[model samples]
Target: MQLIKPFRKLVVSVLLIGSSIFSVSSAIAQESSVESRILVNVDVIYPVNYLKEEFKKISSNPTQADVVQIGGQLNFSTIPDIQAIRFSRSFIYDPFANDYYNNRNVGGSDFNYSDQASTSNPFLSATFTERKGNPPLTLSFNSSGSNPPALAYNGTSCKDNDGCVLMHYGYSEEITSRNALTPSLFKTILKLRDNNGNLVSMINAMATPIVTSSSGGVTQYLIAYHEQSDPANNGVLMGVWTEIPVASGISSNSMLLQKQLKDIVQNQSQSPRLSYSNSSNSKITISNTRYFLSSTQIPLDQLSRTSLPPTDSRFMPLPNADGTISPGETTKPVIIAQTQSAKKAMTWVINNKVDVNGETYVQARYDSKTNPYSGDTSVDQTLSLLCIRKSPELTSNPIPEIAKGTTYTNSWSGGEVFAIPEVVGNSLLSEQNADNKCQEEGQKRYSLSGFRMAEFHDGIQPSGFGFYAKSTDPNLSISNVRYWVKINDQNANPWSK
Candidate 1:
């Protein structure tokens, strides 16, 4: 029993040692495999022989010469695990080829056909030729289902000169299932790079909702057209488009594809008009007569021309030649003529005893009649004249002080003026009574004041008044007193009794 127990223990020890050795060997093998894969991916990104072949193919005359020059650089460190790289190239037709060559004028001048031909270059191809390089050049690999499996190449041209580089044409591929590398799944990558093999930028991809992860790498080719300096040497024009093709597994392919797509979208041709819409509104008519130019009231001098109608003969009458009225002779029809000035017209009406509304009437014709004209017996006529001439001046005149202690004021220096006084006496007063009761009201210890009337002259005269007052009593205090006037010719009867 003892011997058996020792033998069993020995067997167990050997088995444990052997298992440990096997485990170490397996781990080493796995590490070596990973390293081999990394090296392969690195070589694919910098394949010297493949690049040379690509150059040769691009430069070939009739067979495969659409590519012009491949520019930019390839970077593999962006995605270290996947071996990502980015590249770009330009494409143009070979002008030196016998069948496809033609010297044509583009933008009023003839440029070598082999020179970089781009849309903005203002150069037109004499003959449209088939493209040689694969459009939307793609790289494929296997990777996690989430990672995209394809990458694409993008093309561009210089804006200023053919020799310069500019990105123009680009496209993106739809990411599909892990195993599928369909044409639609390819995309053109656009990237910026310096002379050295260093990436400057990666343009965004064009299509959206890329099903695959942004993992694929990118490759760039500079399409260059070689033109002879001498004009007579048959001018052999050639171009080359080169790119480093990665042969690593799916991860490397995914990295390159992502980079290429980004380049194509961000650096390629952009739409000139991003968006547009109609902008318009309903029409409006404005005129000086209909609307004022500014809130600031204008003086008479600044006013535009105003139109006045001719006076009616019935509204105005002139003195007869004879001293007495002729028997059976109807009163001479009053004749009124249009006047340029409002002051002149008012004077004529007052002095001539115009039969306004079939009754003789006159208001204060001048400054002398401010006390009320004596000859005009017709109250209606007098009131009519006062309404036309006196009230306007009263409302328009600037406020004047009534007395040292009183808040109300009056202006007697004016032409014709009138006002409505707020009598403190309880009884209401007629227009005639109010005029004569001024003294009575004054004697009663009640304040008698005149309020200025709005201005009334012709030819665009302003018609408004400004009044201000201050009092301790809230009810008696006048916060604001403004006056405005408009002609009421329909109700006016200057000669009515």
Candidate 2:
């Protein structure tokens, strides 16, 4: 049995009834007040003293294992009309070296490593005993010391070091209005483990008669110590863990790692969903569609790089000051500069590409001030343009196949050509009338109004022609519509009279 002892004594005294008659009376009167104060002070002071002595014992050596453990007792009593008395015995352990290392004594003598292992345990313990005839009270204990070492490590035994293990004992008591004792008990165990699930060190502690009551008052005791194991030459280390033996009302096995992981995965899978549509083109657009796919649908990393191409060159890149248009630069002028007609000026910057699951859409507006309308201010007005990157067959079917001098008519919905008219003026009346008449004719015809017939080519070109209608008298409504046209001719005037 390795035993370490710690003994402490405290004496409190109150004088009463001296030899002189007058002096004895004065002593008795002072006794009660003085004794009461001493009792209160002692209850607080005893625990503090116990902790302080423990610290001093631990700090005196290089390691906790250096101290010896001897079971000792704490004695408490109240002196007659004077003060309270209290004392405790300390338990200590011996220390042992884990390995031999080079060292020198105080005289600077060099000592080589030795194989002789020293067996010493430095752990200490203290005991408490209550003397009869004192008030019942509660006491608490805490540990204080230099910083302890880390309990766990990822590396091998020799690579990482061990941490300190501190043990503490404390008591609590509940007293009724009648001042009777109600005792409670508690115990705690703490262990430190590494990431690999290996226990590195541990601490076991307990407290008894935690709660008690008495006529005088409530009294309690505290004991605590620190212990460190011999460093392992095998390169293993320790970590921190906690255990409560007497958790009177706590539920067992309430927290687990599997449940926590399941919650995390579920939350990530049910993230917010989004949908999109290209209303201007009557096409469905989807943004972030890749996020909706299962892992088997496609490689997760490649989804972010996917994109759709532009519908047409109507939203083509603009040359910068350096004659180079970098990606992501907007070609359209700002709203402040375009003023009341900002919508028309904004067409050039619209992204014609539709993402089936994206949150954006494409729109086109003609800038009348520029091109084709040159020198024709009265004929200038912004027009909504529709351009689609359809298959070649769709483009060929819409081309007009009539002789230049032949009169033909056609009727078609704006949806057929993906075109919607936004604005029209009286100057384009003849062109608008011809476009409407063609629609009624059940035939779509090409109109060559503002351009020379000689400029017509087999490839695509802006026909400078479209359809329009005025609202009825009651509604005062107007329908301005437009579409692309392919024309083949034999030298007849394409402009309508």
Candidate 3:
């Protein structure tokens, strides 16, 4: 089989942890002329220890078909101008290659190339594990060496503690629109999220706006950084190209993207319905969670991309241990950037009682503490993730005011507690709590009414407000306001939002 060969020599700098910065020594000339386009080179840096372990199996037992593959998907939807994409080349780079060729028995082959069929999915592929064929891109590693070896990219010393390998792959895509002398957008932005799904801001997380090379109607841009600390497992890298000469660095505060979520119902049904007293101050802007969702709707509304936040690890491209954005590097700013296990406080107010198809359902109001009454009710309280169970002891009664410093209370009949401004019912008030079930079912007969993440301020009211059957049960007729705590701690309950 004929091999689609990669360039004989391509210069790649090592800007990973404990590695020195290297310059590109040369560039391969384009074989043919092409239309103006953008070249996005995505390099996933794997730790030396991680790779050593990953390849141990294949190296120990060599086989003809055994190969190691590592790849990730790229997202570019944030860039509005670019509308189409085309696949480019994929290759592996070994910083130790030159040393191996120079009669120094330090490691294995420094450079290797292979061909993979391009697919519509934007996954960049790299496969190298055990050698099999002539001109093979795979090889076995020899860990027998005295002193740690020096990398070809500027003689940077490498050790297992902080060394890294680069699997560089890229795509060439056409921009939907642009100007005459300059490209539509120059700088690219990357947002990082931690494993906990919270946005993390670091000075080095954003790619440096550097135009590494421009040749043959194709412009290449490079983004180099260490693997994020506590990175989201499914994080993605995105960017756009521009003709602008200089790129700038972004502020740490700007790293965490901001979003606003409005509380509005997309679907509402009466008889078993949701009613909001007013819409005043019914929106919330947050920067903590990876994304937010619109609260109090028939079907919850998604308000933002579910992108994971970038790692807090210093962006390693700059090469300094201190890892700060250099004044010179700022010239080309690439655009930048189930279970309820515990008890959580919940307040349920009686909105109304409805009989639906011979089954009795209860509608309760849930809202944030600071929101004003939107419609006709005067309910005031904050909502939380909760499970509700029918109380065999109490009838429907309102506990209007709980003191500010009070922890939680289940007692009722003190006074007439008004209904909450935001009321939710319909499908949320189910005959069976199939969507959410109580984790403490063994002890208490509590069942789940609804479940929601903390990012959503409003959701279906607590489960205890209504009964599923209207048979001879006396509690169904005079069901009153009751509060049941739902577990909301993520650490304790994986289902906690």
Candidate 4:
């Protein structure tokens, strides 16, 4: 079996007791860019003693992967314009190369902790029995330091004051050798009645190192996240993550390369980059955009991308410790940004340029009320990816015009408690408790939802300038409204008002 869970399947969770201040050594969102979502690997750790010893070992001659020399990695997005949260000290690590996961001599020699060694994190016990009896479940992730590692946050899609909700940790589906070592705590992560593995938030249990043959006073493993998440599942093993992979020497100062990295991600080329903050008092001003859906009987009512867009488009990117973006192998699709007054709480993605029925339409899905961890799903508005469309606005502007017709609408009684936005014609989606059961109920359905992450647009196939919504009400009923309109469903035409 692989030393770590496949990045795309599932993860671990536990409440962390740590602190952090921003510094960059690391990694952002845009079209083709996957938002960095944090995942936990509780099984990895790095003893401080190991670092000190390694530092000493390399004092005479440094190996290529020397950590004291090279720094940790960052979690950057694909788009140049969008920025990822930077952690100067956050670098990626490897299990095979560094052997941080299972602490021991580089040659695989098992060792013991110092006679006066401190116990590892409590959750360490939940996954292992290496020491027999140590405090289990103690989540002191870089606790109370001005520079504790940051778990990941997209900086958008949050309420006035609430940063995006973090759900990085998850439990293993079945106990493996790591957790099996301590079967007693393993059950806690299983399907217990009240507390299951699915609930623990190991947002910061980034590293958890065990005793290895290498003599060291402290060992703190580096943890990195791939672009994978299973909200409906449980926690990642106790561990650590780094933005840059340590297949070779990793600097402790690579955090100094923020601007150069940001410059490489030219996402701001098309639309203006929107800024969002965590302060509830901090209000965002969305530029002019329109989205309307009016009956031919009411031609005056229209929907335009110019009028409104998805409310919020900010969330942490997929935790790609390797720093891959733009359709990363493990990265999830990007989240669409909004340019309107009301913020969208649910998430939206372009499923198809047009529907399976082969009409000139776009489709997507969103299920915010239930499990948001089911890849490509969002719970809050902080998404920073581009939406999918058929053509760039330059060539395909002015999509085929549909004569105004009677408005068709329907309602679902069991609507989402947290009104999510599913782009028009989208279907492959999951609700909180409604796994694989996404549905719509209307005669001539046109429930266009999801975000528009692209910085620019060309009225064309897949690319649309039309109606989508984020119901202001909790029930997701249409009564609370945000309707949009555009010039005949394409880029703004001379005819559009």
Candidate 5:
């Protein structure tokens, strides 16, 4: 198993699509709600020789793509272990509905236009050819016009003299998976398209390890892509672009096959409804959706980019120093300082997306709305606390310690952003609450993945399911517990590659 260095850094350059430059402020953020941003910093690494052979096919013509699709699928055959699986997906900005500014363009909105930078463009491969070395590139969200944002390949843009796409191309896991079993790294089947709609579908794909086990085993992986979009067209649903290939050499009666079929049926039956809305527009709820073929071609201009509903306005209550709830006490999770970690969590939380150890660690919060745990709205309040200290680290790329004899694995795919709840404190909450929370919230996001408590807890104790440590500072009780979703200053990039 060969692994290339996963992440590479790149500088950003804004794209100038037209001569008429509209001097608009970058983008205003909403403090009272959960805001999401695009994560351009995370990168994918592939062998130079591998990319070169693929590049030779479509280097001559850059703008003749017939159809372009932006998502990939997981190959279950690569993983040998026999166990359960969970798949889910999320989006920061939808390119098929409308643009972020509510302005519909001739071809597509800025979000859709920016997405082309990664796919349906040959600039990234051309940059590699020019530099002769794989220097990194950065894709930023510049919501200025109907053009894609400019990406610098190692701080340099491609000259017009060189024939290439206007922007670079990169891929990521629009749909990701997690499993408790220590299965082998998954093989992804990716489809690469260049300017003019040429296709170079990729098989046996590998990606960066976002989370690893205590033994240095990768727990989760981020499948990279050149471009991505929610499956839709002209305000109509086209369905998700995904596939699951049966691994070769596995027997028909193998547990892996049985498990795969079971998971699909179980998830399909419990799929939830997702509602999208703007200020005065009625909510557009999408339910009972289907998956699109991996080889299908989707047009860029007709692709939709709609605004996501603002994060839940309500806040969760904070526990006292003794880890007990207070009555009528609803202090939202606070962000005392604009630390990198705080920005990561708040920025990506709105989309229910994360880099695991790279961007932010986002876990689904339990459902306190539908079936209240406390059975009393007052006590069943959700709490959002931002831990300032790193000790007993709240987030790690390595999997957290699990309970003795209990096995767990997790996978992330794409779904709508639902509340990510952490079940801590005493038995006032049952273990079942945590399980139901994942189902309830996952469903609301239009997903039905299994829930594992150890994903968030540092360690479980007979006393409760949270992390507590001794601190020297006495002034750090309720004040140390910070809130983020309600703060007005916090905002994240709405689109990422």
Candidate 6:
């Protein structure tokens, strides 16, 4: 009996240990199945090998190119994951990055990028190429110009020797470096052409030594071609470029997105409208009634652009901070200096094309005057204890419908700005006539997509929507316009590849 009892206890212990092992194994399998990874629609392709051979040839002696493909893409989606390629210059940039790699003949607006060095600006691909220096090597904005200017012997010529193709690149000065390499690497082949538009030379730009985020990197490559007397007729056009593949991340911090939103609102609450008054100019010719916004107000004995509400010139009474109401108080009030009759308020389109993020896009307004209040205007109101501190904003916004592209993932409409005053006053005799104190006034500027109007009234409509352009034709006018935006999004990165 004693022997049998001991054997039974051993069997129970073994069974309990087996149960724990199975639980752990199941958990591990579940976690593995759901891990996140990055997925891209296109893969990156580099031109390093071809470029290396071509560079060898150039060093032997400069020469013009034959037709070559600088950028490449799979005719169809390739399997597995997208490839990212990186391209590095033969040498590192100077501490100030002011060498010929970043400077030389480029000047004026083109050199504006040089000043961005402090911010570690990105090197963007040039939209177009130009010639510079004394007789600026015969160049034209229109590459196809029939009369090519004569090239200067002392002008911008082919580098190293006469056999050089002119190439343009966007550069970022080293203000600060995140060295987000891999993702920043790119590859492409240079296909050269002559003034008459014939293929002249071709070379592939190759890869560089692997660089980590710790050590900043450069974006560059080189080519040589015969200097054309009329380079415009013989100038080279840019070809395909591809981004090198890199391990994907969710990208930066989500807090940055939130901060961008707050900035949009803050700008709207204080931006101004545009106005023009030539000592002369009158009404319209057509039956059309042009609309405009006017912070303009009547200068009554006490009312000014700085007027407060109730007895002030701009807006009505604001509920007291304590949430108490006074006798004979009305929910709304009339101000003597208002730019528009509250009843005339209609809709507005407020923008001229401006840069947002890194591109230029315009906004599409939706909320009309009558429907303005329907929008969720939770924009914060700044309160100032002392005038020196930025005061709380007293503003409202009309809802907007922004333009979007297919596959657009999200939309953020900061809405249109509306400026008004606040007042806390009452009808009394001693404290009497309820002295209306003027609170600091402010303006709201409309901005979405990172840009707001630099000047106001760019799009002010008393009745219709606002846009940056204008046309006399009624059928194709703002009234006839309609806007729609579409969107798409994918997980930027996943735990599992």
Question: Which candidate comes out best when scored by lDDT?
Answer: 3
Native-referenced Cα lDDT, model 4: 0.20
Candidate 2: global Cα-lDDT?
0.19
User: Per-residue lDDT for 1-497 in model 2, tens only?
Assistant: 01111111112321222211111123322321211111000000112232233444434212222111111211111111112211111111111111101111111111111111111311112322222233211112222322222122221111332322222222211111111011111112222222223332222221111111112221211110111111221111111111101111112221221122222112221121111111111111111111111111111111101111111111122111011111112111101110111111112111122222322222222233222222222212433323222234434343232112122111111112223243222112222332432232222222111121111121232342221111111111122322222223321111211
TM-score of each: 0.12, 0.14, 0.24, 0.20, 0.24, 0.20
How close is each model in CA RMSD to the real structure?
43.9, 38.5, 24.7, 24.3, 25.6, 29.9
**Residue 475 CA error for candidate 5 (Å)?**
33
Runs in model 6 deviating more than 4 A are 1-69, 72-187, 195-199, 204-456, 459-497
* Cα lDDT of model 6 by residue, 236-260, tens digit: 2221111111221222331232232
- Residue 443 in model 3: lDDT: 20
Q: Which has the greatest TM-score?
A: 3
The alpha-carbon deviation from the true structure for residue 225 of candidate 1, after best TM-score superposition, in angstroms, is: 99
Model 1 C-alpha lDDT per residue in residues 1-497, reported as the tens digit of each score: 00001000000000112112111122211221111101000000111122223334434211111222221121111111211111111222222121110111111111122222222221111122223332322111122212112111121211111121112221111111221111110112222222222332221111100111212332111111110011121111111111111111245334333343332112222110000000112111101101101111111110101111112121122222112111111111111122211111111122211223332222212222221212212121112212122234433542333212122111122322222233211111122323333322232232333322222231122221111221112112112211111122311112111
* Candidate closer to the true structure by lDDT (higher is better), 1 or 3: 3
Q: How many angstroms is residue 348 displaced in model 5 relative to the true structure, after the best TM-score fit?
A: 21
Candidate 4 lDDT by residue in tens digits, 26-100:
221111211221222222222222222333543422111211111111121212222222111132121112212
User: Model 1, stretches more than 4 Å misplaced?
Assistant: 1-317, 320-322, 340-480, 483-497
Measured with C-alpha atoms, the lDDT of residue 321 in candidate 6 is 10
Question: Which scores greater on lDDT, model 2 or model 5?
Answer: 5
